[model samples]
Target: MSTADSLAKVIATLDWDGDLGPASLAVDEAEQLRSRLGDGATRWVAGAVEQSLTALHGQIHDSLAPWPIIRTFTRHVLTATLLRLADQDRLPVDTGAIDRDLAEDIVARGIPLSDITQALRSMQREWLSLLIDAALGVRPDGIGVVPALATSVTGTMDAWIGAATDAIVEERRRVYLAEQVRIRSAIELLVTAEPVDVEAVTQLLRIPLIGWHLSCAIGVPPGGTVERRVLDGLVHLFARVVGSERMLRYETSAGTVHLWVTTDRPARTPRVEDLRVPAPLLVGIGEPHPGPDGFRRTFLEASDALRLAGSLGDNGGVSYGDAALAIVLSRDEERARWFVEHELRDLATDSPEMADLRNTLRTFFDTRMRIAPAAERLFLHRNTLINRLDRIQAVLGHGVAERPAETQAALVLAELFTRRPEDPSTGRHEFGA
Candidate 1:
């Protein structure tokens, strides 16, 4: 039997079928073994018995899939096996101390069981050396072609051919796998935006919150510089943890926060949309959809939200959708946008019935607060009003209702943002559908 075969039998001594911890230990042993093998050979061997390693890894790593880990380990094992053969002088001479040092470090850090075992078939550089010594060139029973191979020039040539075959097979296997990684990566990029597109933008954009495995909530704070520092640190860490193109942008206000991240593709360009936002520490609900108008261009919308986050932590920020904000953005760039940002966001626009939310909101301003009355006047039930409010609440999030004043102010801002002149020529922007 080959060394891999012997090891497989030895593995049965560990009872890998039992508990997870023991299985992990078995995996660790496998890793230690591969630490001595070569990376490529390891990969090929793992491929040969992929099913076995899969089962072992599932029993070992438990949470992290055993497949990727085993595959990775297999590569390492092949590398180690190659280095060992070089050491044995059966192959061209090369350094092995570097590998020995690396193995030592891995051992010091306590290598995971997941790092052990798989397709690394224990194919050492001395494959010919061992075969020549044990089975092929010499056999205790008959010495059939053994003695001839050990002595004749043709025998040496044949041995070399076998060695050449092993090396060629490994090289071809590597080429095939490299092509696979490239093709697989391209398909993955089409599905996942981070690595394929606009990944660079997230580097500049900031994220104020993140959690382990997509959980973005920050735990409630007790309030102090310590808490502030901790929370701020968490925010920065969250941004850093996300670290790249997988991130989103956000805007906030006295009553809400909106996200403005775009999608990753060039042709399928993602418009800036609301990102998650809330006071760094305050606990309350915020709207889910884009909030009321604060005239903002795409880039400006994103930038302002990030900037606004620094100044208006307690205030809800960035309430309007890109459509609503885009209107003012086209005309008086700074003034209208600034007014909405600073002065007028919380005035009052008449709230219409839930059904009328799609219509021009400016018409409702005459009532001081038309949302409830309009719903009633429209013969809509109180539940209907609540639902309309709920829809608005879900869209903009519920954070803005900190008090009546904030709610009223947001209402007025909505009206002002929507106000348009009767004559199409009054404002420089040529009004058209």
Candidate 2:
């Protein structure tokens, strides 16, 4: 055969479906050479590639680091290249479908595009080495065959790389654009509080419309910028924990993330501790409710809880519904402050002596003013407890025995407002020692 026809024969072999191993074609000289020499070479090369996958996995360590996928890609590409050489006829090696799928997967995994490029290049090198080995082992006299084989391998790989690179880049771009649209639409639909197409919001955000939903308000301390990578990691982790993609998130300009997570069963709502949120960032979870209106309500409650946590010097998560009374009272800061200051008067100031006195008063009321029980609870002698109560009466200019209910209510207010030290300007920020 002419060199052109020989190359054509090699390429056409790829399109041939019948087995061409030596056992299947011993009688025919041409079939025997192509089988033992061509298909056999490809099989030997594929085995070598399979053995090298573990080492390759170590080199390309990332989200797309599964060895089986790498192994398959390697075997498929090498087999196609070798078959082309055996038939010597042009056969299309269309790996675009697989490339597009891999690209989409890589993008979803948040892996860098460079990793894909590096992985493909690594495959080329490994395949080339095996092809050389196969050539030496099967066709010792065919030095001319080696060059033709090498040319075919390189050409096929380059085509695969170019097509895959384009597909990966385009897929990554599309994913990012879609995320932006979803976030923008979610933010608008939530903030406006107008009745929107719930189905549209659900489809856009990929979250459920009718189910138990808990909103979480996540934010860093003032003056801190939200790290996108950290936030993305948090979102991904949260979704994984819930075992669902039915979650929506929107990040505010002030470095706060408003998130909604839904589950069909109310009992399955994720708890604050389960989230394992890290510092300088606080998370506030809302009560779980059903449907779109529930989502909105829970979001508002979560926002309130976030503010309440900040106010209480709580640098962690707070459940809004659990602390409803305090949260409601905290809304009127001036009134709450005034109520605490006027009601407690000189008794609520920050000092060890005052704290002791306040504790004694609290203990006395908790025991229903029973002197012995109050003293026992304080781990004090009755006379000592009486002396503390006397001190409290002296500070207030009235005895606890006079209108105890009013005093108890006043003490409750004091506990809420003055439990932590007030910063004078920023209200409570630090706890009194």
**In order, what lDDT does every prediction score?**
0.33, 0.64
What TM-score, computed on C-alpha atoms, does each candidate reach? 0.24, 0.53
lDDT of 1 by residue, 1-433 (tens): 4433333222222221222221222354345434544333333334423444544555456453334443444334332333332232122212221133333333344444234222122222223233233333222332343333233323333333344334434444655567556544432332232233333222223321111112122222223122445545544544443333333322222222222222222112221122232344321111121111111233333333333222223232232232233333334434544544443222223344422552322323334446666555656676765565555545444533434354444444444345432321211111111
Candidate 2 wrongly placed segments (more than 4 Å): 1-168, 223-245, 268-277, 361-375, 381-433
Candidate 2 per-residue lDDT over residues 85-144, each given as its tens digit? 555423345535354555667667877767766776777777666555444554334444
TM-score leader: 2
| Candidate 1 deviant stretches above 4 angstroms | 1-119, 122-316, 321-334, 337-433
